[model samples]
Structure formats: C-alpha cells, structure tokens
Target: MSATRSALPRQALVFLAFGLVQLALDTAIYVGLTAAGLPVATGNVAGRIAGACLGFWLNGRYTFAEGGKTRLQRRHLLRFILAWCALTVMSTYLLASIVTGTSLQISWFAKPLVEAVMAAIGFVVWRQWVYR
Candidate 1:
C-alpha cells in the first residue's frame, strides 16, 4: 500500500513533466501557425495533434519508463493511444458540462480539475497495463 502510494506521486511528477513539454510544444505550434496566417481552428487542431504525438513518445521514453532501455514497444504504444483517446473523449464531455452548467468561478476551475482527473486515470492505466 505504501509502495503504491509512493508510486502515485512519482508517476504524477513524471506525467506532469511530460505534460509541460507537451503544452510548450502545443503552444509553440499554435502560435507559429496563427502567426503564419492559418485560422485559429486549424492552428488549434494541428497543435493538439503535434502535442499528442510528443506526449506519447515522451511518456513512453521517460514518464513510465522502466528498467534501463526505452519503452517504445509497438504494443505498448498502441494501447497507450487507445487509452488516451478514450480518456480524451471523456474529458471533452466533462469539460463541456462544466462550462455549460457552472458559474464563472466553477467554470474557471474546470480545466485543471478535469486535467487532474484525467491524469490520474491515465496514470493508472499506464502503470497497470500500458507500460506493464
């Protein structure tokens, strides 16, 4: 039990590290595309796709890394993608509801709250199945 508890914080730290990288890349791509005259929608989609790709590789290589070698095996990658997609879909609905059914303070709280829940879910899936 203690080990599991310890692992959770470690996992979260690693996850957040990769998440910051993803956010940086995503923001950079979005800003660059918009500056180059692309529509905001196009820039947003392109940035997200780029960020997702980066997140997968970074998390595989670093976040959930085990042993000494890289954890970029194809099976793990596929499972991670499937899990991430499912969680992302879930996040969309939850975020939409939060935005629609809440006051300003609550709505403002939606993103980090949703992201935290999604991160916890992702960590469990990754630790137990994706990278196991």
Candidate 2:
C-alpha cells in the first residue's frame, strides 16, 4: 500500500509535465493565430482542438502508461472529449461575456486562463476515470 501510494505523486508530476508542454504548444498556436489577425474566439477554438489532440496522445502514452490500448483508454478519451466540449462552451461564453460586458481590457489573457482551467479539469477527470 505504501508503494502504491508513493507512486501517485510521481504520476501526478508526469501528468503535469505533459500538460505544461501541451499548454505551451497550444498557447503558441493561439497567439500566432491571433497575431495574424484571426478573431480571438476562432483562434482559441482552433488552439483547443490542437491541444486536445496532443494531450490525448501524451496522456495515452505517458500519463496513463499502464492503460494504453485498453477499454479504459477509449472511455477516458471519449469522456474527456465530452467534458472538454462542455467546458469549452462555458469558458468561451464566459470569457466573451466578460470581454464585452466589462472594461477590463485584458482580452488577450482571458482565453489562456480559461484554457488552463479547462485543462486542469480535464486532467482530473482523465486521472480519475480513464487512467485509474
């Protein structure tokens, strides 16, 4: 039991490393698109999709290394997609609403923050359901 419990932090660290890499890639893509004059919402959505693909690959091979090619992997990815879709809609709407409704003027930063929250949530769901 002690050995099993000790592995959790190591696994979490692996997950965090992969997640940060994924976030960096996604942020680069989003920023590039926005700099090229793409609208924030469009660019954000595109970045999220790209990130999800990379994340799925990383999580499947590394984060949940023990469960690759198993039924749990499939279920995890599917549920992740579902959860992401829901969060994406909520985050996008909330960010957009905040941008439009307030004088905060930090539109450039809001999407990344939202994505980070969504990613964290996704990690939890994936760890619990898919990688358990």
Candidate 3:
C-alpha cells in the first residue's frame, strides 16, 4: 500500500500526458472546423464538449482510478461538468478579450493556450474537491 501510494505522482504524470493528447486532439478539431468556415462559436462549443467528455473519461479511468464507485462517482461526474463549464467560459472570454483588445494578429492561437491553463486548474480542483 505504501508503494502504491508512492506511485501516485507517476500516475499523475501519465494523466497529464493523456490530458495533453486530448487537448491536442481538441485543438486540431477546432482549428479544422474553423478553417472549414464553420462559425467560431460553433466550433468552440463542439470542441469543448468533445474535450470535456474525453477528459472525464481519461481522468476517471487513469487519473483518479475511482471509476467503479457509484455514489461518489456520480458526484465526481457532476463536479467535472460544473468545473469544465466554468473553465470554458473563463477561457473563452480571456481568449476573446486578448485577441480583440491586443493588436496581435495571432490571437486565435491563444485558444489552446487558455485551454491548457484551464485544464490544469480543473485538474487541481478535481483532485482536491471531486475525486477525494
């Protein structure tokens, strides 16, 4: 049990890797959609939903390792949803404000950066409040 506990940090690294993969996938999808002339907001929302689902799956399966729980499981799922929603709104606003307010023509690239930050925030919140 002690050794198992000690392995958590390593497992966390794996979780982060999985998260990054999902993030990359989400970004690619969003960019592809936008390049295809889809509405930005539509692409954003669709990417968010897909990324949130993938995050939940990976975190539940690999990060927390509590996917089998019943009652507690439901609560974690709910918390994940709420947390994702909050982070999404914050990231979206931040990206939009930075892009429009700043003279940087590359502001569109800020979306993935914001998402990464929000994902880190969500991981901390989930670990402290939702998982344990």
Candidate 4:
C-alpha cells in the first residue's frame, strides 16, 4: 500500500519534469511565431502541436511506461492525439482571448500561464485515460 502511494507522487514528479521541457519547447515556438506577426491562434496551435509530439513520446516512454519499459502502442497514440486535439483547442482559444482582451505583450506571459493550467489538467487525464 505504501509503495503504491509513493508511486503516484514519484510518477507525478517525473511527469512534471518532462512537462517543463515540453513547456519550454511550446513557449519558444509560440514566441517566435507571434513575434513574426502570426495570429495568436495560429502560433498557439503550432506551438502546441510541436509540444504535443514531444510530450507524447516523453511522457509515454519515461513517465507512464509500464514496468519501466518504453512500450508505446497504437492505442496510446490514438488516445493521445484525441486528448491533444481537445486540449489544443482550449488552450488556443484562451490564449487568443487573452491577446485580444489584453495585449500581445501580456499574451506572451499568459501563454505559459495558460499552458501550466492545461498541464495540470493534462497530467490527470494522461495518467488515467490516455496512457492507460
């Protein structure tokens, strides 16, 4: 029982570590595209797509791999794509709203904040549904 309890936190820690990397990649792409005068929605979608690809592989192989082995099956990828699509829509909408309601300068900071919130929700969904 104790081992099982510990496993959740340990897994969450690993997930968070990988999430940080994904966030950096996502943010960099978003900033670059937005700075180039691309629409916030376009930039957000592009960044999220890139991040999701890396995140799916990283989280699967390291954070949620069964028996400490990297074994990503087709179903996992399918589920991840579905979940990623939903999350991307939500994040892009939120980011775009922030940009319209505020300013691009503010949206630059808001991007990470929005993604951090999404990441929190993502961790649970990925653990319970996507990876499982």
Candidate 5:
C-alpha cells in the first residue's frame, strides 16, 4: 500500500513534466492554425494530434514504463488513440463553445485551462488503464 502511494506521486511528477512539453506542443500548433484562420475545431485537433503522438511515446517509455521495463506495444498505441480521440472531442467542443460564446482571444487564454483539465483526467486514465 505504501509502495503504491509513493509511486503515485513520483509517477505524477514525471507525468506532469512530460505533460508540460506536450502542452507546449499542443498550444503552439493550435495557435498557429487559428492564427492562419482555421476553425477552432481544426486547430484543436491538429494540436492535440501533434501532442498526443509525442505524449504516448514519452509516457510509455518513461512515466508508466513499470520501473523502466515495459516497451511500448501495438496495444498501447491503439488504447492511446482511443483515449486521445475521446479527450480530443471533449477539448474541441469546449474550445469551440468558448469561441462561440466569446472571442478568439478569450479562447486563446482558455486553451491551457481546458488542456489542463483534460490532462488531469488523462493522467488517471493513462496510469490506471491505457498504459497498464
């Protein structure tokens, strides 16, 4: 029990570290696409796709690698895509809603917050099921 408790924090820290990189990648692509006059949904999808690809490998290779042991398999990739798709849909809807309600500038500020919330949920899913 203690081991599991200890592992959670360490795993969370590593996950957060990798998540920052993913967030940055996602945001940059999102901003670039939106600035180019793409729709919010399109930009969000592009960004999430870019980030998700990198995130799967990083988390699988390090954060959730079962003490640096498990190599990523096809199963992990498939599971990751499923999870990513769901999360991306939610993210796109939220961003689109925000944009519809307010301005693109507001949506820009809201992007990180949206992704942060999504990341929190994603961490649990990845730890408990996706990577497991």
Candidate 6:
C-alpha cells in the first residue's frame, strides 16, 4: 500500500503528460471533423476514437507500465477501450450540455474543460481497475 501510494504522484504526472498529447490529437480531430460538416457529437466520436487508439499504447507502455512490469496485451487493450469509451461519453455529454445551454462565448473552450475533468476521472479508474 505504501509503495502504491508513493507511485501515485508519478503515475499522475505521466498520465497528464500523455494526456496532453492525446488531448491535442482529439481536439484537432474534432475540429477537422466539424469543419468537414459533421455534427459536434459525431466529431466527438471521431476525436475519441483517434485519441483512444493513440492513448492505449502510450498509457500502456508509459503511464501504467510499472504495474506487474506488464507489457501491452490484448486484454489490456480491451480494458483500455472500455475505460476510454466510458470517459468519452461522459466528457461528450458535459461538453455538449455546456455548449448548448450556456450563453458563454467561444464554445470551443468547453472541450478542454470537459477533457480535463474526464482526465481526472480517467486517472482514478485507469489506475485502480483498468491497469491494476
């Protein structure tokens, strides 16, 4: 338990580091999809797909790589997808709701905010369950 506790901060930093890359990929995909005439929700799906594919490898090899010294596996990949899919749905709902209901200008800002919130949630779930 003490060992796990000690590792948490480092894990979080690694997670954040990779998450920033994934976030940029997702955001770029979202913007491109939207520019191509897709709905925001559809764009969200595309972005999530792109990010999750990239994230699985990065998180597996780097972020959660210490767990059991485990290398990437099919089972881990499956769990990663399931975990990210859940996060994506949640963040998308938050983003969509905020952009639709709020009177704030620059709705694009909502994506980053929603992504940050989802990353926090993802770190807990990924650390405790998916990667554990």
For all predictions, the C-alpha RMSD in Å is 5.0, 3.1, 3.3, 1.4, 1.2, 2.3
Better of 3 and 6 by lDDT: 6
Highest TM-score model number: 5
lDDT by residue (tens digit), candidate 1, 1-132: 876556677778888888777766766765577567775445545655777788778877877775555678999988988887787667656644664687323533454556567767877888888876
When sorted by lDDT, best at the front, the candidate numbers are 5, 4, 6, 3, 2, 1
Instruction: Summing lDDT over every window of 10 consecutive residues in candidate 2, give the lowest-scoring window.
Output: 64-73
Off by over 4 Å in 3: 1-8, 66-72, 102-105
lDDT of candidate 3 over 14-94, digit per residue (tens): 768877887787777767776787755666667788887887877777677643542247878888778878877786677
Model 6 CA RMSD to the hidden true structure, in angstroms: 2.3
TM-score of 6: 0.86
Cα deviation in Å at residue 49, candidate 4?
Answer: 1.2
Model 2 RMSD in Å is 3.1
Which digits, one per residue and each the tens of the lDDT, describe model 6 over residues 1-132? Answer: 798888888889988999999999998887777667777788888998888888777877887877557637887777877888888888777767765897223446667778888888888887887776
Question: Pick by lDDT: which candidate is best?
Answer: 5
Question: Where in model 4 is the C-alpha error above 4 Å?
Answer: 2-5
Cα TM-score per model: 0.65, 0.76, 0.79, 0.94, 0.95, 0.86
- The residue-by-residue lDDT of candidate 4 on 1-132, one tens digit each, is 775455688789998898899899999999999999999888899999998989988888988876777737899999988888888989988988898899988989988899999999899889888888
> Would you give me the overall lDDT of model 2?
0.70
- Candidate 6, 59: how far from true, in Å? 1.1
Q: Candidate 6, 11: how far from true, in Å?
A: 0.8
Candidate 2 C-alpha lDDT tens digits along 1-132? 775366578768887888788777777776778678886677667877888788777777776665234323566777778877886787667656766876234655666677777767776777766555
